[model samples]
Target: MLSNFLPFLYGISVFVLLILAAKIMLNGFVSSQASLKTQNSFSKKKKDDRTGLVTVHPELLNKDGCITDEDLLTVRFAKDSDHPQSSENPSE
Candidate 1:
């Protein structure tokens, strides 16, 4: 009697696992579609040259929404040295 019931138990467990897998796949697909829907709606509401994500600061843009010619600021960091700057053992 026990041997005869084992096959049925295995079939039920396999069916349950299959159902769980299907639910996981469906959830992923639905969440992805929802994200796409939100992104599309956001772009449709904005409708601008800037695609994807746009910065909140638009002060640099001109009347045509293009950046005007301007000087770029550059930053330079001091190079690291293993020996002290005042070291007298400088190798010639």
Candidate 2:
């Protein structure tokens, strides 16, 4: 009888440990997701600040100088371009 009870007690302890481990993992996932959401919101807000400036391709300045709907669609921020000056550190 004692031998049978030992196996039963072991199984119950193992089950409780598994449940505790799952709870710990779930809590960690929830906190990390919340932190990730906060980080994404911060980055989105920074991007919104830069969107106030819209620059067009310099070649578009020449004849057929008029900006069309398609040209407007292609406009982007000057600081976001591939220019060397845009990549330079402000502190330098």
Q: What lDDT does the true structure give each of the candidates?
A: 0.79, 0.77
Tell me the tens digit of each residue's lDDT in model 1 across 1-92. 99999999999999999999999999999999999999999888877756566664576777788885665454555784453353236678
Residue 40's lDDT within candidate 2 is 94
Instruction: Please give, for residues 1-92, the per-residue lDDT of candidate 2 as tens digits.
Output: 99999999999999999999999999999999999999998887786545577767676565677654342333567778564343335985
Which ranges in model 1 have alpha carbons more than 4 Å from their true place? 47-92
User: Each prediction's TM-score against the native?
Assistant: 0.48, 0.48
Candidate 2, residue 27: lDDT:
100
Model 2, position 14: C-alpha lDDT score: 100
**Model 1 clashing residue pairs (backbone):** none
Best by lDDT: 1
Residue 9's C-alpha lDDT in candidate 2?
Answer: 100
- lDDT (Cα, 0-100) at 75 in candidate 1: 52
Alpha-carbon deviation at 39 in model 2, angstroms: 0.3
